[model samples]
Target: MSGEMTQGCPPTPEARAAQRARTLARPGLEAVRVKGRLRANKWLLLRRITQLGILALFLAGPWFGWWIVKGNLSSSLTLGVLPLTDPYLLAQSLAAGHVPYKDALLGGAIVLAFYLLFGGRLFCAWVCPVNLVTDAAAWLRRRLGIKGGKTPSAWTRYWLLGFTLVASAATGSIAWEWVNPVSMLHRGLIFGFGLAWGIVLAVFLYDLLFASRGWCGHVCPVGAFYGLLGKTALIRVTADQRRACDDCMDCFAVCPEPQVIRPALKAVGQAHPLILDKDCTSCGRCIDVCGKDVFRLTTRFDRSES
Candidate 1:
């Protein structure tokens, strides 16, 4: 009687799995299709806008003279786009016997503006060529399932900061322009070929194939500088505390700047809602990926308050 009863019941596990599969398959497919379409549209728009901007730059490049130009703008008197040009300007300033800091350009208004609006990430997103190259490298790494470890502790960026200041002092602010990857790439594109050209082309290609923007977290001196200044910025990436945050570090995993994210996650508490690390670039990547809606770019300085 028992054997017969078991046979009549059959396999409940198999039956239950079949039902579950049917329930999940359609919803999953629909979600994929919707996501695909949105991504396609966004890509199309970005392509068109970038093409127009590049055309404008190409036309403007010759007029401005990428090497250097004699202008009357005082601080930016020598208008050019090449990395070495800044060095030249610094040399010129020294030759003319001008002291540093006594006449430092206070034109960091744009940088400050972005900090006020979105934290220290304005320069990361808008300027900095190294950021661009690293972003591309990250994209390539991701598409290929490439995982990179954190930078060596010995290679801390504060050394680079000191170097820039010393160089700028010696060369008349040319140090900032010299190491700038933006100026480096622009100069290479305009006047270099062979090895130099190959380097730039490879960076661009890698970005096309990978996560593209992940490299910024690993390197980028200018980004580091802004990040330090960013602590006092009006806008910042922070997490909300009202939600149940079981050690589920989803926010940290998705963050491009994990150095900043990890500390913030560990320090989050009932009283403090946001992660306010000096290393935070305020990229907002964390906010986009948090499932619990416990993350946001907020205006408050208190990182504990979300």
Candidate 2:
């Protein structure tokens, strides 16, 4: 959401402590009872606000004739003044041998700097429309206790990222955008994506049937590019109370990238308390679900150990 990931009414210290005594199969269910609904879903609701608010801004032009923001997520001009462009899209243009104009480069730079300061996959967790679809599938999978299909390589996204760039160079086009689920979802909402909706559905099914978070985590080149950009992110989720963790693993159940949790949550050696993995989405669901108040959203510079 806002990188702060801190808002809404929080529960009392006693209510928070109530969570340590219970671990539910449904993530956050215990928190819902102990911390109240709003506290349990604080970050998630904030992310929905951001995601839906961005969509509303984009749709305002077409539906209401009010041009708050022109263009979609790939490129946009806000209030006829500030230009915000997707840097990954800019990279594809470069690979396609297109000489981007000065304004375009400026737009990309503005966005690049913003994401660099925060975590890059903030786009994935907070804004991208397809994320809603994928998240639904993941929720359904977990609810159904569906397990074991195909475990896609976590490295698959990196390879896909390279292929997209090389394909753009070879084809002289932004190759990946041709089938990008995000673009398709945006177009589908405005007008009609037609058969393109199938690709989006395919992504959902893959996550539901094949694996949890199969597409965004393992296959999407866009996520891979942003994950790489996130390596130097200043905003981080830290395990400030790792010592209080009861090994309930609720954080893992809720996290999109659970692999990023251990280093911070179990910092035994030289590991810092910060969740430093580039793949950490900074989605704040970990913060939302941790009953012990183990995880926190803060600057990467904080060296406080749990």
Top candidate, metric lDDT: 2
lDDT for each candidate structure: 0.46, 0.84
Off by over 4 Å in 1: 1-106, 109-118, 148-150, 170-173, 186-215, 241-250, 268-271, 301-306
Query: Tens digit of lDDT per residue, candidate 2, span 13-118?
Result: 5545443333323777655666788888899999999999999999999989999999888898999999988898899999999999887899999999988888
Provide the TM-score for each candidate, comma-separated: 0.57, 0.90
Question: How many clashes in each candidate?
Answer: 18, 0
Task: For candidate 1, write residues 88-203 as lDDT tens digits.
Answer: 23343454456534223232333345454565654454434444456445545544554444343424555665566666666654565544555556555445534555655654
Worst 10 residues of 2 by lDDT: 1-10
